[model samples]
Target: MISMHKIFRRLIVFSILLQLLIACPLQAFAESEEAIFAGGCFWCLEHDLEKLDGVVSAESGYSGGDLINPTYQDHSGHQEVVKVVFDSDIISYKDLLKQYWVNIDPFDNNGQFCDRGYSYKPVIFTSNQEQKRDAKESQETISVGLNIPLEQLKVDIVESKVFWLAENYHQDFAVKNPLKYNFYRSSCGRDNRLKKVWGEYKY
Candidate 1:
């Protein structure tokens, strides 16, 4: 038989254990995930991806480059990428892949739109094997839909590298500078080309 104090102590420990069991998985489920993509201007990508339902945040950044601690001024080798943090429970990674496909021209290898350089090249950076597999599957599906060979699809499905966040001003340039963002996006011919390439299926 246990003493009252020992019984009370055991009850307390059991309560703590119960709390951990209930809270741990909920905390894990609440955690968001990051997906990196380089599709022309980071500003536009940030703007477009954030509009999606499950996206928690879209931050402009530089990745797939050799530079260490790169900045907007000296990021020559880096591609302008957007680091999107999203809720996996709310949206599937495969759907995000589809959204990425419609938003940019996969055929262009030089760069996307008015931005002409390796830095603006469209890419999908996968952080894990599952992501890589899904990205490739999405790529293949798009290739089949367009009747283009897999090699013809210029968009890359590379393993994610170090992502250097861009300057504060560059983060949400679209939301902050609506007029300029619209002007730049329009002048760059992003929307028109997207409509032409994606047709009625444009996102």
Candidate 2:
């Protein structure tokens, strides 16, 4: 028994509501950006980066390798990396890079903390020219601030390769296995090394 006028008004209202809903998500998606980094242990890096204010998620993964479907035990040539998705409106990529330097030892080319070999090497994986430029600039800023030579900064800034998501059990490892992760992190001399390298710098 609804009049045509009322029905047309209802349709108009519904159309406006649908447009708003669709536009909101598209706007958010446009503001979202991603950056990848490898600072030794994926569990520790993932845990650390996710704590940043604007970061949406930090996912553990493997990158800079050719292996397809790499696994924890057999990811040869792959580095343990964390893919960080962040809201660009809330935080800048430069800020994230600053945090990254404090969390890692740039002098250690072999590996990070107790973790060794190729998989643990520190790296900044850039997805585009802008990221690469930002990373280099950040590295230079850190070197000057720390009074260290640029050549001494061992963290490689390279173009990002295909990022293979780690196994389900490896995701959110610190959250899932806090006690064990804590014990391992403590025993690995990570904090001590970071303190020596960064000298009370808060990340």
Q: Candidates' lDDT values, in order?
A: 0.90, 0.92
Model 2 lowest lDDT segment of ten: 22-31
Q: Best candidate, lDDT-wise? A: 2
- List the RMSD of every prediction in angstroms: 3.7, 3.3
Candidate 1 residue-wise lDDT at 120: 90
Question: Which whole-number lDDT from 0 to 100 does residue 84 have in model 1?
Answer: 90
TM-score of each prediction: 0.85, 0.89
Clashes of 1: 0
